[model samples]
Target chain A: MAQGQHHIIPIRMLAIVFGLLLFLTLATVITAQIDLGLVNVPLALAIAGSKAILVALVFMALKYDNKVNLLVLVLGVVFAVVFLALTLADTELRGTIGITEPGTTELTVEPAESE
Target chain B: MSSTGTTLKHYFVNHEQQFDAAKLGMWLFLVTEILLFSGMFVAYAVYRSWHPEVFAQASELLDWRLGALNTVVLLASSFTVALSIHFVQKGENDKVVVLLLMTLLCAAIFMVVKYFEYSGKFAHGVFPGAGFEPQGIIDGKDYSKYDIPFAPQFFSIYFVMTGIHGVHVLVGMGVFVWLVTRVARGHFSPQWYTPVELTGLYWHLVDIIWIFLFPLLYLI
Candidate 1:
């Protein structure tokens, strides 16, 4: 196919990607079943992200398609990351910044009682 | 428009340019879809972070087994859609119709499972928003125990996210049915199957969203 034309992907490649996606789906479920403490969520997300990438690259034919479309996809994902990261930065750091009343940190030093 | 069905528009120099333009437009629209779902993901993350314990306890009420089943069904549907595109490119219109039918069947199966899951939740008094109550016990897990603080948030997000995604699936089914008729009429061929390719991309994106949803909501 000419550059930037309708390029046909091999059925074999698509099948392989599909198999990989199914395998990762099982992996995520299995890992979720196992309690790995802090690792569990991140691990599941990583696997899920990989599956998404696979679908975008292979099944969506981004790999064989124009680079401009790939650029668009990448930029979209980047902005999404920025949105999530900035929002979490604010939400996670809410109480610690910019709004503490002065006396809230300590009780009034009770005056030493006199006779 | 030209006499030949596959001819390019006057605005485009050639067929490749026209196809690329259409594909680019589709990708732009898909990006907007990503941004749309990201807002909900942010909500999910914020709420889950604030109430980890509540989220964990609440998620237990969702049957992960059913979620996993839906995940597999969606992935299979995505695969079939991809295969349809492959057959279309090869000019195998009959096989393309068959694969598209398989995709539609999978979408139906996914929705039926979702219906059961939603009704099951409703039967237990588990609902979104103002009606957030869980009562009775099923499968030996007391639903009443899930009626804790911020638990409503979990189910609300669950219903909203999955409900919207379910709507997408229904829309996809409608589009596929239309495509099936068009394919039977021989509207797509190796030289020009832009609609099939674009629709396949859209279907895969719906599947991708579910891949993340299955993990975040059910496996939490």
Candidate 2:
């Protein structure tokens, strides 16, 4: 509170943000219950990211603390995101599924059938 | 400077540096933990995409309402754990003890919830082996071929990931108990309260792990 005592974001604002996180998560789950195609993961991540930012900035009191620590924390999440993205790209690119382009020879090797 | 002597000045300086380094080091370690768990999350995502039906069936088998409750409990405990650190920084040992107790109680409740959930799964033969029934979907209709929740392989990963997380919760409870004992014995002060700070980092790691796990395991 010392650092942000004079100009810190209001506690009420934080409380509202937390409340919103709960509601958004609930909404996301309900939305998932319905078929939303491929929007589910990204939508869910959006809600999670919002909630995470709130927890980090407010409940964890990173706002009152040093900015360096907060940046380090954010960097971790960013790196995780990048890691997931790259892995997904690798997996998707290696195995082309449901795609039939010209001059395409897609190999579908069944592990069990190989034996 | 062979680092052989032990004067108060030298000790204090070393302690200060180590203590300061501890927080940063813990943060880096936490980042690594996040990335490690992220692997499971990615695996879960890819499998779910490929086997949406089985994953959904498996999710329905889970007690999601209980999972939601536990999630809130953890989020609240993070608040208390943070407050414990705050009290320590402000030279409020009594408050720190109260917050620590609350945090420990929250952890106990988490474990209790998890115990019931696991026991229920065990009762349903949810474990890997012949117990697992594979439910494959055909077209967009109801094709109940064994109706296995995800694949047997998927269940294995689920158990491993959640099982590891459950261990962390137990570890957190143990650490909380230690904090409570030390607080009761008047061990922490504003000048020397590294335990509370370090513990906060650990609890936050627990919370962060759940933040990812909840969605990967339940929501989607």
Candidate 3:
């Protein structure tokens, strides 16, 4: 191997990132306990996304690593998002293409009561 | 070049090229890992949206306290793994071994907690698919009331996601044990700690997936 210099992350920085991650975990739990109605799922996901980014960027050393590696990760994430969005588009819109107008119910059975 | 004690492979011009190639390969592997989990995530999304109320009520049966505990456990393990990489680069094999041990311990704890949670659910006869027959009382709550339509789907998704994640944890533990042995034998140095670095990245990805799973399965 060529004599390549490796960047040593400071102990203090690692400690701080760890602390922040723990704090965010606590935040997500507390926020979940409260009823946020429409914002609940998005809120939980946002917190998770932030935590994932921190782990990827700092804990995994992507922040200080080569750009090519970062590009690989970013591409992976982008494709995952594409997979989600396109699939959801199809699933969520199932049976909505009829000429009798969307939102029309074909089955007369009442939906089961939940809870 | 002799000062660093780093060996250059004949196939590569220098260590930087070799390191970059390895790192990129790991990232590609990580991408496949992400896609692998994405299929489950898609299933989760489709089912949850289709049966929001059922998903919500069924999720309530899960103990978030245990989930939170595991979350903390995984995050701490991820921290220790990261620290291990840092120490490896500093040529502190002793610290690396200790940190790797800590990471392994955390993974064990997470699995143990999961075992208890699974046992509790099983005791109530709550299972995925056709086997679901939730009965008896758990934590003063009546499990018998969870027989609503689409409830099975919720439990199915839950079991599949967590079960796979647990398997990953086990795999990580195996890798860490191997790493500990290698470190103890003085096999790693500041010059070539690629295994430690790659293993850390894999562990962090495990942690990241759990970060999403915790909220989606337990809190939501």
Candidate 4:
């Protein structure tokens, strides 16, 4: 056998993770039905995030895999967050930047009118 | 040389190196898949933030029970795929074939449920883009009541996201069927199961994407 020949994950651990995932799914549904004001989206995302981590770690066997693979997965997730955050920053604050100077607009307008 | 010298290609030094390279490639591919879906998630977030009430109301037209059922089905499929990998490691080819078939069955069930959900929506003229006309009664609620401004955007995103995800499910079914055939032919063993592991990773990622989609599209 080779050095990395086998790493059989116990069936019990897989079952436990599967159970937890189902439980979290139910929890998210119950929470969503209630009006949680602004916290609803974040709460649901948090639950989903945990479930994703569980799948990646146990079911996918990243926990027992090589470090480089884990690093690759983490980088992928980090870039995804960067994409989400940067895009949201722009869309969420579209009009709040106030890039237009109050007097500059009028000055340019006057020149254009005179011409 | 590794025990399965026939399985190791000439370019690779040993089975371990080949496995590492293949796994790395799969991870890179998974990264691309993440970014591919991220674009849709961003679109969803921007639109939902703009029309929170409309998205909320529009999402209600979706039956969360169905969404949750598919979620359970996918989670179970992911579990079975994981077990198949475990069995492959132990050289239990029969168990591996059975598990892959089970995973394939789950994928088929997921698609069938999606078919029902999509048809139900289309029957009400609830389509993406300008075709959206929420008429007819669903779950005893008047669909016409949901025809608010920007509701079309909500449905458009819904259809596009789930539609792409559904396509992935179909592709997974094909992959599993092929895998099952190979397993029954005794092509994989403890020393050479790269394809099985790679496909399992792909399937798990498909499941992970739905984990987020279920909440974003159906619940919240």
Q: Rate the local accuracy (lDDT) of all candidates.
A: 0.90, 0.70, 0.90, 0.91
Candidate 1 residue-wise lDDT, B1-220, digit = tens: 1125477679998888888898999999999999999999999999999999898888899999999999999999999998898888888899999999999999999999999999999999999998989999999999998889899999999999999999999999999999999899888878788889889999999999999999999896
Per-residue lDDT of candidate 3, residues A23-54 (tens digit)? 99999999998998999999999999999999
lDDT of 2 by residue, A1-115 (tens): 2211222344465456557656766776677677787897788777777777767767655676556677788898888788778877876676666545544544644345455
**Per-residue error at A26 for model 3, in Å?**
0.8
Q: What is the lDDT of residue B82 in candidate 2?
A: 69
Docking class of 4: medium
Better of 1 and 3 by TM-score: 1
Candidate 3, B77-113: lDDT as tens digits: 9999999998888888999999999999999999999
Ranking by DockQ: 4, 3, 1, 2
Clashing pairs in 3: A1-B7, A1-B8, A1-B9, A1-B15, A2-B14, A2-B15
Count: clashes, candidate 1: 0
Candidate 3 backbone overlaps, count: 6
Candidate 1: stretches off by over 4 Å:
A1-5, A96-115, B1-5
DockQ of candidate 4, scored on C-alphas against the true complex (2 decimals): 0.67
Docking class of 2: acceptable
- Weakest lDDT window of 10 consecutive positions for candidate 2 chain B: B1-10
